[model samples]
Target: MTIAALQTVPQQIETAAIAQVRPKILMVDDRWENLLATEKVLKPLKADIFKAASGNEALSLVLRHRFAIVLLDVQMPEMDGFETATLMQEHESMTGVPIIFVTALSKEEKYASRAAEIGAVDYIFKPINPDILKSKVKVYLDLYVQREQIMRLNATLSQSNEELERFAYICSHDMQEPVRMMNAFAGLLAENAEEAIDEDGRRYLSFILDNARRMQKMINDILTFSRVGREEILLEPVDCEAILRETLSEFEGVIQDSGAEVTYTPLPCVETSSTLVRVLFQNLIGNALKFQNGSQPPLIAVMAEKQGRYWRFSVKDNGIGIENGFRGRIFTIFQRLHRKEDYPGTGIGLSTCRKFIRLCGGEIDFTSAPGQGSTFHFTLPSGEAARPTRSGQQAC
Candidate 1:
């Protein structure tokens, strides 16, 4: 036999086992006879059928187990189909559970519309059309199977991601010690043994110390990036305008040293982590000041415009713009376009911006041409959830 044929037996057995544990379907009616008829009609599907003689019993059964589809009767004691469906619609768990009303009611347009308003998926008459009933129920069953598969895959992927993040944290933490020692001893060598070394030897020692310092910064950034996601982030209404001003004040020395003229328009508050939002502005503004062409003072402007469900923010700078060829890797970790001698950086700033933007459920993009300056744009959750301000006063 061929190798493919040889492997068919075990595969078939596994498929059969999964199919054997059939999807659950709830059949609800005051009449025991009606419930039995549904079970008999649906027997070909080989599903795990649960019968309830009253609406109350059906609700009780639903609370205990998850059903792929619910076959409900319109006429019942204590509670009716509409009431039960309304209750199901309100429930957190049973909200997505499809319900098909097995009613003997007239086929008037209003009757169907009423059921729809109450969230009924479909309706069937007194004379159960076995073919139609099975067909409708089959769609929900297939959907349920697909949903189960997706949930399982998501769970597996989540576990793998958690493990990867843990590994990153451990590696970054372990690396800090060695980098610190190299930096400290290199400093000591430069200070105490400089008289005995030649000029080139001293130069080599300087390079070692500089690189060691850079490595230390990069390691600390990596640890922050890895650990931030694990930290408890309390999200709320954050005033974007206020955050920008506060960050600017903190970087007052850098701004004055660079002779940069920073200006911004009214910025709306957004729903996000206040701490991370400040970090994002700090990095973006810092990059603008750091990447100058040395001929003119930096002119940076920040603006926000609403775009549907998000606010599209732009940080425009008149400094050295990114070349089109290297733009693709701009957000990559530790990727720098300039040499360390010309531009001193660990290349972790923009990458951190990309990370925080995603964590807050948004995306980032930029437009730049070499030496013509660049405008970086990113989207964040709009200020719909922001705290209310006065009639004319801006919310920071």
Candidate 2:
């Protein structure tokens, strides 16, 4: 069957358009004749050439319009070019605008040198060569256009990502209520009709109920995965040792059943999302116990060691190690190594763990050999990278 929704989703996400507006150039000079001549030379370039008679006028114009480049005359009556440049530095928006100082060959050469010291990009001698001026200004204008395009593309991409995440969240949420109802109704039928229904009927109902529960779990996993992308990344100092302990508490039943021996050291505080941190630890620890080798108890150790600007964390486990062939695809969505009957899972744990680490500006990877066990590793920025919190003071 041909699906149309997937094909149209991308187009819908790209609803925001990027505008190709003309580049804006600001010209400041004391004499109208100079401004008029410069405007005539730049006319062929097809830009919005804005002329300012004084340095104060130029500053006011920049406040209203984002200029690609500023053409400033060194010798202005009230506010000289040097003072104007200094004042523009105060206005944050004018900082990046390339300034080309216009100096006549007849003027004092020291003004040119002074303009250079004042952060002017280039000096164009008076009796300005029209061709040279156009070409040089064109270079800056082209660069400005390219930078604007990048900003537009980034905005569009960020919006698209948010939309897709919201879509997944809505689908998973809507899918849950019906699946829960199915499981509940199936259970009721099985209980009330136990005497009337045959053994085969009971088995069929059990199969339906089991499959429904699995579907519910898969939907929940999808919700969890999508939720991370929607939530803002809160980078604050988080004590990894505390988070590890909390994560282990969640898997208490499984840890006891598997006779797992979990050990960890004083994991230092780091800049990270507290929620995703817990998810990362939970998945890694749960995977260790779930994929145990033979009947032997699982041995898991969590550690965090400082690595210059960031902290390198590792969860080493003695369990059924990953096969080399499956390493690359192990973190992919819905990709699993074992069957549902053997090792039950929605195949989203590793993928979600990777997503969580990425959102926190960190990376997660692992090393394993079949029967040799696996070691999952990741790195997060140290607390020094984040704003200091009073509660996160260097405490235990």
Candidate 3:
């Protein structure tokens, strides 16, 4: 597609127009001659320069305009550069704006240190070298421009991502109804026409019904993945043990029929989205049970440990483990290593688990042997180490 067409969907294109605007510069000094001299040195840079005769004027100008850099005179009447810088830091918008202290005062280490402490990017004495001043200002100016470009690009990229997710969600949701209808009709035909049709026809109808059901499941999985991306994450104190218990309960029948031995230590409460955490546990535990070693009962364990500022959780299972080469694409969506008859899944589970972990500012990975087992580990942000409500291992 053409670049223009790419930008047409989701939102209007504003980056190109905004990037063309010149970076603004604010020169603040008690004397107009100093401001004029500084402005002259910086003329080659071709920036929109604003002159302020005093700290008050500079603050006022900054409030009205976004400046790439501010050159403040250290010694100003009524309000000094240090005071102005401190005040500027208080304003959210001015947080990223860099300031340089221009002073004719003593070049004492203490003065420079004080300027540094007050958040001045640089401190310069009188008789400023035009080359050095211009070079330093140029560095900050280039950085400012690059920062703005990045911000704009990120905004554009985010808009595009949101649009794509919405489209996927809509498509997956809309496709489900037709797939369900197809499955239902195929089932009805199989039941009503079995006596009238040949064996080949019956087999063909079964294939159609099977495929329709599979397609519906795939669409449902896609919708689940899309919802993970679109949902707003609200962090709250969620009991890990409680979520795990609920997840295991959902698999109670499978655990019993497969002779799976599930156990977990006392998990702690973490600050994260409860729904997302539950999804994480559900996918991991389901994989543990589904991928059990041939004729070997599944032995699964869930455990958690407190790491600095994070809670590390591991779901270890004795199952048919991942191979060395396939590990790279193991988490890829729809990437199947086994036949549909052997392992029934859409291959969206692990990818979805990765997405959920990352959405919570966490990391997820696994280690496994080809035939032995696999252990999936992930970490979530823990605001404070939560005290476990109980101790000892619980098994089901």
Candidate 4:
């Protein structure tokens, strides 16, 4: 078939096909002739073509419609194609829109390089070839349609995640209130028994109260974990050394009683969510002190170092340490090797720490062997590193 005939056939099919499929395109150029030329070149494609005579008008059309592809002219006055493409990228919905430059310039290396740098998908010279343009636009339009479908799927998935998080927060909050009430009334009954209850009855009541309190703590941790992703984290410079010192002071009584020797080199400033980082260090250090064995004083060390793209922090404790087999299981919620009477924890500390690290765009892991020592390691984005805020200062 001839080029004109070939182009005309698709236009006829597209007019009918586009009635059901509302695929759109934005055509941008300074010259009216260039704009008409692009429209003619893309006539065969099954799309709704919108025209704009300037970069500003192109941007307005982009804001109003989600175009499958943008045919842009490079040498427009005021805001050129590069500037227009950059502006389009700033919009979340337009970030992935395919941009093709239709310019009169020859195949020069500088212009070609600049086009790629500004994220143009293809470059077409003036005196357009209808057949070639038809094929090129067809390829990009098909890809754009596929991308739109993927975006729709992602939107659905994101909505589902939000719903799940809300459900967890509500369920955990509602469950804990009644559990606290049960513990309170159980304590009152134990204190004021009409006729002194038997030793067995007293033991059962104590167990009920203790378990209820533990459940309450777990529920609170679960709620915190669920909300971390939903809440907006205020990023700021945070002094790691100061936060650690304050956390140590909060556990002063425990440190003194256990005779734990805690030492740390100076920590550098890092950009992060201060509250979350404090909770992170508190849990790690507290675990170190809590798990000591054989009455040997716990020797804890906290250190930080710059790794590529992230800062790696380590908390090393010369305490009981974990077995190699159970190392992976320790970070999971309610997955404890020791009984409640022995460890005295609800087994939610490490799980909460993991959640906090993830919220800060980081990861937490560990290495341990029985009776040696355990070192918990975590990484935070280094680009976000900054001087830490003062102690007790709220993050903004």
Per lDDT, the best of the predicted structures is: 3
TM-scores of the candidates are 0.68, 0.75, 0.79, 0.60
Ranking by lDDT: 3, 2, 1, 4
lDDT of 4: 0.81
Question: Cα lDDT of all candidates, in order?
Answer: 0.82, 0.84, 0.85, 0.81
Assess the local accuracy of residue 63 in candidate 1 as a C-alpha lDDT between 0 and 100: 82
| lDDT accuracy of residue 380 in candidate 3 | 91
Which residue pairs show collisions in model 3?
none
lDDT per residue for candidate 3 within 1-396, as digits (tens), equals 334655585344454325654789899899999999999999999589999998888888878888898898989999998998888777777887899999999988999999988888899999999999999999998888778877777778777767767877888988988898899989899888899989899888988988898888789888988898677888888888898999999999999999999999878787788887888898899989999755788999999887878889999998989898898788888899898888888989788888877988999999998788999999998865344444532211
| Model 1, TM vs. native | 0.68
Candidate with maximal TM-score = 3
Name the lDDT value of residue 82 in candidate 2: 81
**Candidate 2 to truth, TM:** 0.75
* CA shift of 211, model 2, Å: 3.1
**What lDDT would candidate 3 get against the real structure?**
0.85
Each prediction's total of clashing residue pairs, residues at least 3 apart in sequence or on different chains, is 0, 0, 0, 8
